[model samples]
Target: MRHVLAAATLAVSATACVSTATPDTEPKGVVVDPISWGPCTDIVRPDGEPPARQEPGVRCGKLTVPLDYDNPDLGTIDLALIKIAATDQSRRLGSLVFNFGGPGGSGVDTLAQAAKMFDTLRTRYDLVSFDPRGVDRSSGVRCGSNADMDAYVELNTLPPTQKTREAGRAANQRFAELCKRDASRLLPYIGTGNTARDMDRLRAALGDAKLNYLGMSYGTQLGAVYATKYPNKVGRVVLDAPLDPSVTFRQRTLAQTRGFQQAYESFLKDCVKEGCELGDTVKAADANVMRLMYKLVDKPLRVGNRRLTQGLASTGLAAALYSEGAWPFLETALAQADKGRGDALIYLADSYTGRSKDGTYTTQMSSFPAITCVDSAERPDEGELTRTWKEAIKISPLFGSEGAGGICTSWPVAGNNEARKVNAKGSAPILVVGGKGDPATPYQWAPSLTRQLGNATLLTYEGQGHGSYSSGNKCIQSMVNSFLLKGKVPNQDVACAAA
Candidate 1:
C-alpha cells in the first residue's frame, strides 16, 4: 500500500520471522492444511478471457494462519494460494514464490498479471502468491477513516526548520492517535516478520522443501528475510531492486534522496543530448525546473479554478522520479507549471496518490503507515533530523527537502526492527538485480545487499526504472527467466540495456 515515503521505505525491511522452534516441532496452535479448489472470483484475466481452464494438474487452495503469530490461539486468518502443479512430474522443482513490489502489493494480483508473462515457468513448477497478512482479500488491517491517511499525505514531509519539524511531529502524533483509536488490535501483527512466517506456513501446507522466490522492491527484502531465517529452504531466489536491510529508515530515505538526485541528473543529461523540447543544456533545464518547484512552494498556481500548491508540486516531482519512462511527461508538466498551468501536474500528483478524478482513493495507502510504523526501529533525534534535512536540500533542492524529510518525525510508535547487517548465511544462491537509473531503490543498494547476503550474485540493468523483468529489457528478462527455470547463476555481474 502507498504510505507516505517513510512508511514505504520501512516496509522493505518488514518480512515475517522464522519460528525458533525446529521444523519437526509445530507450535501448539499453528495449523497447516491444503485447501480445496474453487472458482477464483477475483481472477481478472487480460482481455476478458475465461479463467484459463485449470491445466490438468494445477491446484488452488487457501492456507489459514494466526492473526498474531505470538498468540496463535487468538484468531485465524485465511491466506489464498494458487499452485500450478509441476508438469515435469518426473523432475518437479519446488514451489517458486512471489510478492509483487508493494509491502501493499497484492501477490494474487501479481499472479493474475504474471500468468501471461510466465507461462513457461508455470508449467515446470508450482507458482504461488498468497495475500500476506493484512492485505486485501486476506485478513486486513483497516484505519476506519481516510482522514487519517489524508492528513499523513498532506503532512509537510519536507520539514526544513525547527518550526517545520514541530509541525511534522504534531502530524505524526495525530496520525498515531487515530490509529490507536481505530486499529489498535491490528498494529503489531502487520509487520514483515510475521509475513515471512506466513510464507513458511504456506510452504509447509504445500509440502515444499524450500522456497524459490522472485521479489521486487519491498518484496525483495521479504525474500531476503525468508532466506536469512530459513536458509536451508531457499531455492533459486531473485531479489530485484533489493533493499539494504541494515540501514535505518532515515538512512534509507537519505539514500533514496541521493538516488533520485542521481536519476534526475541522468535524465537531464539524456534530455540535453537528445535535444528534447525541455531544454538545450542540462544545467539550464535543471535550474529552470528547480526554480519552478521553489516558486510553487511560495505561491501555488491556478489551473482554471483549482490551486496547485507546493505539496502538490512535490508530489508530482516524486512521481516523475519513479521511472525514466516518465521523463517526457514530467518535462511537459514542468513546462506547463512554468507557464502558470497546473492541471497536468496536479493530475499526475493525484495519480501517484492513487486519487481518482472522482475524488475517491484506493486502499493502497490506507494500511501503509500502520505497517511501516511498526517495522522500522530508527527515530531521528532532533539533531540528526536537522542535519539530514539540510543535507537533502543541498543535494536535491526540489525533492530532498520536501519529499525526504517529513513522514518519520511523527511516527506513532518507534519501529520494532531497525535496518541491520543481513548476512543470509547458508542461504541458497540468490540473484540481485539493479536498474542503473531507478529513482526509489538505487542501483547501489543492489551491490550492498548482494555483498551482505552470503550467497548472492549481482545482475545489472544499464537502464532506467524501478523494475527490470517487465520493464521492456530482453537481457534482464532472459537472465531472470534462465535463473528461475534452470537454476543457473550469472557467470559474473551481468548488464542489461533497453532493447
Candidate 2:
C-alpha cells in the first residue's frame, strides 16, 4: 500500500546483476558474503510469555541485516522474523517468507496477527516474515515533524487545470526539498530493487537454499523484482494484488482512481440492495456522496471541536474505499456528513491518518509516505501532470484525476535505476492472486504480471479488497497454504467468492 498524503487525502495504494567463475565460486548474479551466524539480540522479547515461544508450531527469531546492502560495513539493521518450521522435517519444504501490503508495513506484525490462520502450513514448512528496510523496528526512515505530515495530508490531489497542476508542482518541489534536507542519505536507497536485494541477503543469512515467498500489494511488486533478478533461486512464490510493471507512475495512480470509483460504485449498489442509511437508491446516494465531497472541497465541516476539511474528508473516503469490510462504516459516515454532521467523517479521517482520539499518530501515516517517496520514480511535472489529471478525472469522476495524482508528484526523489519488468524465467512456479474488486491494486494486473513471469499461474479471487489470502476466503487460503507448504500449484484458475 502506498499511503502518501496529498492535500489531506492519503492515496494508498526492481533489479539485475552478474559474473561467474566455478562451482565453489559465487553465482553469476549473487552477492555473497562470509557466512556469519550469531544469537539474535537487537529485540528485547516480551516478558510474560517465553522470549521466543513458538506460535502453535512457528518459531520466531530476530535477524540483523545491513541497512545498506552495497555498504554492509556502514551499519546493521534488525529484522523481526517469525517462522513456522516445517512439520514434515524428513520431506521438509524450505522456508516461505510472507510480506503484507505496505511498503512500510511490518511482515512480523502480519505474521503475529495471522499466525492462527497460517498454522495449516506450519505442518509442512517454516512460514517466516521480517520487516523490510525503512519500516517498523527495522531501522526505518523518518522525515519532518508531525506538522509536516499534517501539511502533507493537506496537499491537494486534484490537478485538473493548469493552475491546480502548478499548485501540485509547487507542493511537490517543497516536499522534495524537505525530504532532501531531512532524509537525504536514506531516501535514495529505498526502492523496490534494493528491497528485493535485501530479501536475497535475508534468504542467504537464514540459510535457505532458495527463496519461498508470499507477497501482497507492494509485496507483489517486490516479489516480481526478486523473481526477475534471481529466477533460479526462487521456490514456490505467491504474489497478491499484483501491480502492472509497465505502467508509469501517473498511469498507475490513475488506474487506482478508477479502481476506487468502481469499488465505491460496488458499495453503493450493495447498500442500495440492503436499503442502507445512505440512500434508498444506489445512484441517488452516489450522486449525493459526490456532491458532498465537492462541497467539502469548498468548505470543510466541523465535527464537535475538530474541523474536518475537504482534503481530510477525501482522504478518509479513499481509505474507507480500501476494503469491503469498511463500506458499512463509510456509508454511515457519508450519511452523517450528508446531514451536516462531520464527526463520522472526522473519525474516518483520523483512521486514514492513523491518528488516535488523543491526537497522536500511529506510525503508519508517518512511515508510509517516507517509504513511498523513495521506492518509486519521480512524479511528473506541472504541464504533464495537469494533462494526466484531466484525463484521469474524465475516466473516473468520483475520484477526480487530480485527487489520484496528488501524492507521488510531490515525492522528494528522482527515479532510481529500478528495473520495470523482472525476468523470472527460471523461477519456480509462482502463484499470482488478484481481487476482482481491489480498489488499490486492481485484479487486471494479475494476468499481466503472470504473463511477465515465465513460470507463473494466475489465481483469481472473484471478491473485493486488497489481498485474498487468510482474509476469510477458504479456497484462497487453502491454495496459498498448500502451495507454500508443499509446492503445490493449482492445475487451473482458482476462484473465491466475496465474503
Candidate 3:
C-alpha cells in the first residue's frame, strides 16, 4: 500500500487434509456447509523456478467469509490461505498465523519468498496466512493501471496551494471512484474490524482453541483490532512495528514525519562512517537532500519513460528508510539522482507504489486507502485538511504534505470502527516488538501500545529496521520463538543489540 505517506494479504496450510464438522454461518440464520480443505493449486513461480526457500509442505485453500460481518448473510467473499505444516507434527502446538504488513501485501507471496525465515516455527507449528479481503488473491480492488498509478504517485508539487491541494483531492476522488466502479461490493466490507471478525471465523474453521498470530507494520493494527474485538479468545500474538491506535489520521502522519526524519539521520551517520559519497558532513548531506527535492519540484529528472518528481523521490527515500539494509542502495540512488541519473530512485518509487514491471498495479494502493480510511473515525473536511497540510509542511518540509492525509479526505465512506485505545483486557499476555530505527511505525509506538494494552510486553530491537524477529536477530528470534511455542512473555522489556 502506498502511503500518500498513506501508510500502509496473505495463505493457510501445508500438505495436510484438515476439516471440521461444525458448519460456517452467515449472520442471522444462513447455515452454510462446513469448509473443506484439500490439495493446493496455482503455486507457480513467475520466474519459472521455485524460490530457494519455499515452504516444504505448503498447502493452499480458500475460506469463505462474510462480506459484511454486521449482517453475515449480506454476501460471501473468498480469503485465500496457505499453510506450511509443522515438520514435527507430534510436537506441534497449533497454527501460528502470520501477516506481513501492507494491508495489501500478499502473505502467500511474502511467506514463499522468506520461508527460511520461519524455519524455526515450522518445526513446532504449522504456519498459516490468508489474503485479507480486498487484498491480492482475494476479491481485490483494481482502480487503475500501473501508468495511472505512476502518474498519481509521481506528482511533482506539494499540496501547499489550493491548486496543488485540489490536484491531490481530485486524484484521491478519482481513486475512490475507480474503486467504487471496480470493487463496489468489497469496498463497504473492507476494514480492520471486519478483517478481525473474519479472523475469528478463520480461527473456528481451523479448529484452533485460540489464534496464535504474528503481525508486522499494518499487521500490528490488524492484530490489535483482533485482540480488542476478541479479547477472551486471544492466544499468543506478536505485534511488530505497531501503531498508536488511539491517534487520528493527522497524528499518524506526524509520527511518520518525525520517524522518517530520524531514520534518515541514522542513515546519514552510518553513511559518513562508511565513507559514502553523499556528503562531507551531516549538515551538507541534509542540505543536499533538501535541495535535490526542491530541484525536482521545479525541474523533474527523466528516468527512462518517466520523470522522477519530488513526491516520488520523497516516497523512494521513505521506502528505503524501512530498513537500514537499504541505506547503501539509498545512498547510491541519491548520488545517481544528483548526477542526473534517476533510474535507481524510480525503481524505489515503483517498489513503494506497487507498480509491476509489466505496467499494471497489484491492487495495493487501491485497497490500502479503502481499508485504512474506513478503519478510522476522523473525516476531516476541507478546512481541517488545509490546516493539516500547513502543519505537514512545518513538520518535515520534504514530506510533510504527503505525510498527512490527502487521499482519505475523499473517501466515499466513514469507517465502521472509531479510533480509540485498545485495552484488550481479557486477552492473554501479548508481545509487542519495535525497532528503534523503524521509520514506518516508529519505535515509540511499541511502548505506547504496550502501555495501552492490559497485559502486553515490549521487546525492542535497539537497532535499525522495520521488523526485528524475522530479520535474523538471534535474541529477537529466540524471544519470539519462546513466546509463540511456549506461551511465555519476557519478564520485562527486553532490548536486543543491533544486527
Pick the TM-score winner. 3
lDDT of 1 by residue, 10-88 (tens): 1121122232333222456545776676656665332223355544554556788888766767887787766656667
Q: Candidate 2 at residue 299, lDDT?
A: 69
**Residue 311's lDDT in candidate 2:** 66
How displaced is residue 222 in candidate 2, in Å? 0.6
What's the lDDT for all of these models?
0.67, 0.66, 0.73
Write one digit per residue (lDDT tens) for candidate 3, span 1-499. Answer: 2211111211000011111112223345534334465555544232223345434487778888778766867978898888888989899888888888787776765665556678888898888888788988888877766666777787755535667767777777887777767777778778877787778877877778888999988888788777777777789999987877776666777777777778888888889888868888888888888788888888899877679898889878877777566678899999999999888887777676666556666667787887877777678787878777787777776666666556776777767443243667668889999888777777877888887776789999988767776556799999988998888788686789986
- State the weakest 10-residue window (summed lDDT) of model 1: 5-14
Query: Which 10 successive residues of model 3 have the least lDDT summed?
Result: 10-19
Per-residue lDDT of candidate 2, residues 1-499 (tens digit): 1111210121135112221211121236655453333333332211112236334454555666566767767776666666656667786666778777666765664565455555677666677777677665666565566667667666544424556556655765676667668767666666677678778877886678888887878788788888777776788888977877666767676778788888878888989998888778987887787788777766678776566666677777877776666677788888888888888777666656655555544345545666665555656666766666677778775576445445666665665535465657766888998888888887777887787776788888888766777345888888887777767888767677765
Supply candidate 1's per-residue lDDT for 186.
67
TM-score of each: 0.82, 0.82, 0.88
Model 1, backbone clash pairs (residues 3+ apart or across chains), number: 15
Identify the runs in model 2 with alpha carbons over 4 angstroms from their true place: 1-62, 80-94, 123-125, 155-166, 303-305, 340-343, 356-379, 402-412, 497-499
lDDT of 3 at 24: 24
